[model samples]
Target: MLKNAALQYYHTVCSPNISSLLELRQSRKSNFEGREHQKYMLVKWNEISPNTILKKIESNDVELALSTLVINLRNIRMNLSPEFHAEKILYAKLLQACRTHPAWTIACSTINEEDTAALINSLRSNVATWKAQNKPTIEQFPRRDLDDSEILFIDPRYFNSNSN
Candidate 1:
């Protein structure tokens, strides 16, 4: 009976009418452009509180939280707003904590402290490079033509010389 049930289940899942499965897979693909997807991911991250990630770190679930924190940091690094700046700093600190925290040592844990530290350092360097590249340059004064006046604003009376 069990063998028959297993065979039936396999047949149903691997049937010739697999279009449903293909459609499901395709639907999961993102239609958003790179920047839009980043914004969407940021909005999703906002739903997850920092305290929850801290709790995961405290419980030695560093691997789970590390990726999230890293991505959050990378996403917000480009934002010049004060709130985003604060969140970026918080995420970086959390990532640092993940790197220094003792290894979980479980069979399921894939990353070690050294590896986490390396990833964090790489991300920090990338962020620094991005900031340097995107830094705002001082606006240069417009070049003056030879006949242009030094006076920025001319008085109306100066134009109408006959008016006393």
Candidate 2:
């Protein structure tokens, strides 16, 4: 059978080298000369990698940095409309992103609620812990009255003249 041959070829020749599926499609609108009016979308084809945000948090050690990510995810979810599959996929992506944060290890380990709020809360709590531990305390120093009499006094020797 033709199907049998195709399966055999796919398994033997194509399975080993390729790690992922490469989808190629030609745009019907390619005939248009200029594409300036077309809005370029990022997530349409490119996947947002967790490593991109992980590096920033690792470098700065700030939990607030994660807020932007949370907001972006929320926006994406809202914009995705009625696509349940896309929303679930986005949630999974966010959960994966949350794993990269050191303080979020516990939260990321358990899959209680697959939502952005839960993840954001966990990040916020961890940030609070970091803030508490690293709280900026003003160090007090003993104040001493500056003695200015010596500096104000002029040397008497300067007034004395040995000779004209």
Best-matching candidate per lDDT:
2
Using all chains and alpha carbons, the TM-scores for the candidates as numbered come to 0.23, 0.43
Q: Each candidate's lDDT (Cα)?
A: 0.49, 0.55
64: Cα error in model 2, Å: 2.9
The alpha-carbon lDDT assigned to residue 147 of candidate 2 equals: 78
Give the per-residue Cα lDDT of candidate 2 at 56: 54
The residue pairs in collision within model 1 are: none
lDDT of 2 by residue, 37-124 (tens): 1222235212443445456567554554576566556554443424533656666766777676666656677658877567667667
lDDT of 2 at 128: 76
CA RMSD of each candidate after superposition: 19.2, 15.0
* Cα lDDT, model 1, residue 70: 66
